[model samples]
Target chain A: MLILHCPHCDRMVDETDLHPGGEAHLKRHGPEADAEAFENYLFMRENPKGVHFERWRHVYGCGKWFLAARNTATLEVYGTYPAQTHQPPQTIRDTITERQPGWAWGDFR
Target chain B: MSEPVSALRGRATSGSVQVSDMGLQGMISLRCDLSFGKLKALSKDLVGAPVPALREAQVRNDRAALWMSPDELLFLMPHTEVDDALSRIAKAMKDQHHLALDVSDARALLRVEGPFAREVIAKLAPVDLHPDVFGPGQVLRTRLGQIAAAFWMTDAQTFQVICFRSVAHYAFDLLEASAKAGPVGHFPRGT
Candidate 1:
């Protein structure tokens, strides 16, 4: 079992529990979001071919969002970060924080 | 020779597009303290072996499948025997600081097996389905589509997937999509 460090939690978990959220740099606009907007947010995907930065959640455990760099072809993860501060994009950090979520998590459930 | 081969294989010997009506229809929620004595003995007796206090999954063939939590287990059985099992668990667990609940209506169980079942499991859930990673008698509390599912690998080719009755449709859709992708080539890739 591979344990990955989630930026938000600053910890590791068995790959079994964490849900891969695809690419995660979309900004949440308004309350009454439209179907097109929601579709773009949900269905539409970046599907990068190289080193890609994406958002993830410690869904089953911590509920925090993370910035993870992964290789698309090899499926090797390079690094991960918390949704806390603004960091300059690195060769590995591809997904910039467009509009950071108020909190990178829901609850500590 | 054809008769002999057919007889050797019963209804489902398993191959491409094989289907088995897995007739499991009940679930029981068991909350017992691993630190407790009576409950541990009862679990061992029922399983006919020592119940690992903290392992996630254990199986004893068709008789039962056991799961371990921090201090809980959810046992599934045939619908008709739910009450009997519950009472048995209760009687065995008396004088112990544990809770046993019959959550039969909380979730539904289905067995989806074939070469393609793991491919379907890869889409929404996150568990290592490879035999080396997820061996037989392993269980995981994960999601299937949007519904929470408890997955149990009963054997190399058979798996039991469970979810609340409400989101059964989504599970079916995901399974269909996985089948379309492949029988073995459909495992989940990294995001």
Candidate 2:
């Protein structure tokens, strides 16, 4: 089973203690947005093989939602951050880029 | 009022583990922003100790507050004193954004004690139960077998596991089965 560090509790918790949320940092499209944009926001996903960002809730532990950046194929978690932010932190992106050369994630390289 | 029946009233001890239903205890599920200075002080006043840190517990006399999550805690005391405890806490936090509910009858508590207690728990829980990791006063909320449960280590050889009243029988059965199976084959190591 995968183990993730919950930023809120500062503990390395098993996957069983967590609930996986879908892709992270998705901008919400409300009534102000066009139909196509709203549909894409709801139905579309990156589904990338590597370097994905996702949301996770430490349901059984801290019960706080957090974001995780990781390589989907290797399951190597780059880092975990609080869920309140609208985007991944720059330090986490830099670390990912350093670890996986030439890797790029949405709005980050 | 009708008397409450224990979940494991007539279970016989098996192997080195002894499981006993703790009967009824006052349980209050409390939720608040612990980071707020005033609320933190109020919690301490209510529980007679500071809010526990992370998975830890703050115990004083016969009362305790187990940290269930960043924003949640479980207050436990003698069953007869639950109502008083609830009212006092409610009055203290009348102006705060908080939720407190008396959950004394909503869950059942089972106590497991013996030299093999850790092993018995290890078989059904994914947590690392090494002495260094989960010693006395540490509490955790996780699934025991297929049912969600919370438990705390009261001493070296004893643990208190709490699950919803609806699943108490299933939890007891699972624990009994694990106890009868003897030592767990593998201890979970950090992944």
Candidate 3:
């Protein structure tokens, strides 16, 4: 079973205890945005093979939503952080950079 | 309101494992920033003890507060004491971004005791029930046989499992089946 470190509970919980919430840090598109922007916000997602950022909920644990930075291919986890921030913490981005050189995700490169 | 009847009635126990409905107990879902000094003081005053930290529980007399999350606590007391507890908590948290709801009737409490208590629970729960890892005062929010449940180890041989009242019977059945199945070999340390 996949184990994920839940930042909220400060515990490494089993994957069965968590609920995957798809991609993380997506900018919301309101009525003011163009059709293309709205469609991208709703339907478009980055299914990259390398470094990726995603959202997960410790549903059966702390019941808090958190973000995880990991490599989709190698399953190497960079870090997990609270989901309150709109962007990943700089420390997490730096860790990803150190592990997977030249890797970029969203606004962090 | 009519007197609430237990979901399991008289059929909860099986073999060495005794699963009995705790009946109607006062339950309050409290949410607030515990880091706030005022809130922390208010919680101690309301629960008659300091609020529990993560994955921990603080017991004061007949009442106990279990930490459900960073910002949430589940307060347990006698059913008769719910009104007084809620009013006190609400007044103290007034104007704050806090929530205090009386969930006494919405849930059911099952007391599991005896030697095989942990083993029975381990059959259906994914949690590590090893005594060294999960001992007294520890609480966990998890699923038992497809039903959402929260439980706390009251002692080495006793666990109080709380689940939604709607699924009380279903939960009891699952617990009984697992209890009768006896201990499994999956747990390395054994209960």
Candidate 4:
């Protein structure tokens, strides 16, 4: 069982007590965007083999949604932060960079 | 507008632990930023206590306030006082971005007591029930079986559980079953 620290409740929550909300940081394309852009926004998702950012809900605890940076291969969680953040905080990025050197995703390097 | 009745009709069961319906309890769901000065002031008047810190519960006399989330609190009192409490909250929080409502009838309250009360709760919830981990002043919102529930220790050997009224029977059955299964001897007797 994967245990993750929920930033909202500040508790190490069990995986069974949380709900996975797929990928995080999906930029939505409004109606003004082209078909391809909207399609990418709706369907395209990152399934990286290494570090991944995902959304999770502490459904059984504080009932707040938060983001997590995790290593898909090793199941190592780098950090968790509130969903209100636009992107992972610098601390989490630094932690990930230290562990997985030369890691880059989208516009973030 | 009719008489208020508990979901379990005040039924109780005895096994290794005592499980009983706590009857109608006045509960108000107040959702607002906890840092708001007005909320701190209104809560003092509304519940006779300050807003509890995160995951904490403060009980004084017959009134109590428990933190449900960072921005939500549940206030408890006598069943007959729900309307008055809601009105007071409404009047105090007008022109503010807040949500306060009478949720007493929407949920069921159960009490679990006995030497093995902590074990019974541990069998279902994912939370740590050790005295050092979850003592008197802490409250947790978690799942009991397949239903959503919240629980807190009234003391070392007594626990109060809250779940939706619609599933009161299920919750009672779950608690009864857990109690009937007997203590696992996982937790030592006495603190």
Best by lDDT: 4
Q: List, residue by residue over B1-191, the lDDT tens digit for candidate 2.
A: 99866566545455677887888778899898877667567667667878788888877766788988888889988888888878887887888899999998889988888777888887888787777787777887887988888888777777888899899989888888887887654543220
Model 4 vs truth, CA RMSD:
1.4
Please write out the lDDT profile of model 4 over residues B77-118, one tens digit for every residue: 999888888888888788788999889999999999988988
Error of 3 at B45 (Å): 4.3
lDDT of 1 by residue, B44-155 (tens): 6555444543435656655454563555676655566788877888788777777887766655555667765665575556555665566566666665666667777676
lDDT of 3 by residue, B142-188 (tens): 88988889988777777889999899999988987887777665554
Query: Against the true structure, whose DockQ is highest?
Result: 4
Among all windows of 10 consecutive residues in model 3 chain B, the one with the lowest summed lDDT is B182-191
DockQ for each numbered candidate: 0.09, 0.63, 0.73, 0.80
Candidate 3 structure quality by residue, lDDT tens digits, A1-109:
5677888888778788889999999999998999999999999999999999999998887789999988899988888999998888889888988988898776679
Q: What is the RMSD of candidate 1?
A: 11.9
Better of 1 and 2 by DockQ: 2
lDDT score, candidate 2:
0.82
What part of the reference interface contacts, as a 0 to 1 fraction, does candidate 4 reproduce? 0.73
Ranking by DockQ: 4, 3, 2, 1
User: Which residue segments of model 3 deviate by more than 4 Å?
Assistant: B40-42, B185-191
Model 1's CAPRI class is: incorrect
In order of appearance, the predictions have TM-scores of 0.56, 0.91, 0.91, 0.96
